[model samples]
Target: MSYPLRRRLWAAALILGFFVLWEVLCLALQVSDLILPRPSQILATLFSRMDVLWPHILQTLWTTMIGFALGVIVGVVIGALIGTSRIAYDTAYPLLIGFSSIPKVAVVPVLVLWFGAGPLPAVLTALAMCFFPIVVNIATGLASTEPELEDVLKSLGASKMDLLLNVGLPRTMPFFFASLKIAATFAFVGTVLAETVASNKGIGNVMMSASSNFDVPLVFAGLFILAFLGVALYVVFSLIETRFVGWANRKSDFAST
Candidate 1:
């Protein structure tokens, strides 16, 4: 009856409908399990291998968290610097674009070379993958500040730093949190890529190992775990955005609706 209950029911129905469709298609086509296992099969594999998967899941979670933390720190500082100054923005924006264009997966090997194949490479890769979006979003937010507002602040005897600290920083919060949602997903991609490339543990390694043995269900299970982790992290950041940036959120949602 309530809107919230209806939304939850609708989401649940969609997910259930998807799994049912998948199962029906697999059965109707007589699909090979190797190519695509059924959802039930995947769930069975996941539960059977719970002991094996738990450690790798924890490994991935901590690596991603560390990398995400590092990314947030670097991204916020660099983003603020570039956003507040026209000179800095002009000089750095192009360079940032160029840097972001490079595939982070390509850097995993180099990280492995330096760090000698462990969690370090995964952490660094995740940090690298996540920082770019945060930088761009924060910078864009700051750069988009109303010129008239800045002029008014200047007329009121506000120094550049004072204007930036008081006005620019608040404007940047919504963008920063929004970017974190995207960057959190990227952090997962980077960590898993690094793990598959050169790590002894993590879900990526488990998937890779399963692939070698032709254990398709296990591979899918690892993928499922990774997807769960990413979604969970995204939800956490979304909650944070709702709490800390509710004013901007309310305005945006109102406009959209």
Candidate 2:
């Protein structure tokens, strides 16, 4: 098998082994189902309570998708502008760093007050968490463009727009997609955190309610669902990345071969 295929197989085996070990330990220790439910129990709870969980999952997914899309759009525009312009980079980069450094969760209350405790706040929270990585990655990609290649473009009498479109933007595609994966994860996390803090309904609300009633197994079920959703989002983004950035994958394959 090729190296990539072998690596993938190894990873799958490792994950399966880890889960098997976890189940064995849980059985051996006879751990209370409440404190540390086995993976089987969590899976059982998930299936048993699917009807209750699906709507909450949908709500969270909607909010996260909206937020993530908005964040990526805005981050790409802002990052491109800042990265390509020295003046803009110097002026806005520090401010971007400062804002990104601020604890996003700390602003949840203010977002609730401003946007009210609903999907709006949740979307805003997700946007906030999802934007920074995209901006940083895109900016880095733009800035790291090969000076020699840029000079070649210039020598060909390329207009600023042409340079940006054909060179800068293309070079940044991989980094943009990389950031998208991270942003997708953050989008889900941010939505859940916002829902937990204050929301009418969501997976976070369901999880919180379960915790309040001491339904530990249900809480684990909720968490399992969240993990599944996060992985799903990441996989969706990866597929999109692979589709849109096919040249990157092709180049990688050529190099490996």
Q: Which numbered prediction scores highest in TM-score against the true structure?
A: 1
TM-scores of the models, in the order given? 0.93, 0.92
Query: In model 2, which runs have C-alpha deviations exceeding 4 angstroms?
Result: 1-6, 249-257
150-224: candidate 2 lDDT, tens digit per residue:
899899999999988888889899999999999999989999999999998999999999999989989998898
In model 2, residue pairs whose N, Cα or C atoms come closer than 3 Å (at least 3 residues apart or on different chains), thus clashing, are: none
Q: For model 2, what is the C-alpha lDDT against the true structure?
A: 0.90
lDDT of 2 at 80: 88
Ten consecutive residues with minimal summed lDDT in candidate 2? 248-257
Global lDDT of each model?
0.92, 0.90
TM-score computed on alpha carbons, candidate 2: 0.92
Candidate 1 lDDT by residue in tens digits, 1-257: 99989999999999999999998999999999999999889999999999989999999999999999999999988898898777998998899889889999899999999988999999999999999989989898999889899899999999988977898888988999999999999999999999999999999999999999999999999988987899999999999998888888566565544
